[model samples]
Target: MVAVRRGDVVVANLDPTIGVEIKKTRPVIVVSNDSINQLSQLVVVVPLTKNIAHLSPSHALIPKGVARLTFASKAVTEQIKAVDKRRLVKRLGILPPALLTQVERALKNTLAFP
Candidate 1:
């Protein structure tokens, strides 16, 4: 059981989804704080996707290889979700400071943070 911390990109099981929810097993960014991650059974995450053609404030562009992602992807901030920690397969890598900062900004925008 490795430590899953905020800013870490990890693979997760997001199957059994319905409607427009992001489906299948995929890489997701750990957005929840470290304290909550340690105290709670669920881990908050944002799914990544290669669909970056149409950009919006709801999506954060993430460069390839930044977090062990082989392809350039978009962080679907609007699709933020919380899944059981057991659903996390393995850690890919951690987002660097600059990228993580951008993610926070995008997340705030998606959440209408002041």
Candidate 2:
């Protein structure tokens, strides 16, 4: 599990199976390259958002359109306020069959509805 101290800025992995967990941690006031070093094993570190871009230069820079759905899906899932499965589907744009199945399974096991 990725451990983050309180007040650390972090992002969540987009995969539902990976769940809402700290994906990166930026140093206070300044984004450090090391903020993303620990994420190498867990994610591709695509620079899909402004916060992402500030973290590191080595991260893969995904085009905005391609990453929009991914970022939204991850954000919606992390909210997990109620069982709003539609939000997940909508944010994904076009969910892959395998990814859909994995999300369903994770929801069943975690009962994460939001």
Candidate 3:
């Protein structure tokens, strides 16, 4: 199985999406626990978008150069989902600890954790 871990940015084929869902192939952040990634064929992910109009409590601002990306990105914590390992195309790079923490914080707010 592909080795995915929390905070890793991966290129995934998110096609076959339903209406209003993030579509096409894109970068996504792996959010599942390491143990979960190791033991299951699925991993949880949060999609990143270049269409960042503004930052919100539910979005983590990712600077350009992050994960070798040419453009700055934003993590849409609200769009988190799980997909089969087969959907992961490649690992772009892993988010640094500080940025990863920021994403996690936004994710926490999205999940309504205190």
Model 3 has an lDDT value of 0.92
Q: Pick the candidate with the highest lDDT.
A: 3
Backbone atom clashes (below 3 Å) for every candidate: 0, 3, 0
Candidate 1 vs candidate 2, TM-score winner:
1
Model with the higher lDDT, candidate 1 or 2:
1
Per-residue lDDT for 62-94 in model 2, tens only?
223431333322211222321111211112122
Clashing pairs in 3: none
Q: Model 3: per-residue lDDT, tens digit, 25-81?
A: 999999999999999999999999998788899999999899987789999999999
Off by over 4 Å in 1: none
lDDT of each: 0.90, 0.28, 0.92
Clashing residue pairs in candidate 2 (N, C-alpha, C atoms within 3 angstroms)? 82-113, 82-114, 83-113
For model 1, what is the C-alpha lDDT against the true structure? 0.90
User: Which candidate should be chosen as best, given TM-score against the real structure?
Assistant: 3
The alpha-carbon deviation from the true structure for residue 33 of candidate 1, after best TM-score superposition, in angstroms, is 0.6
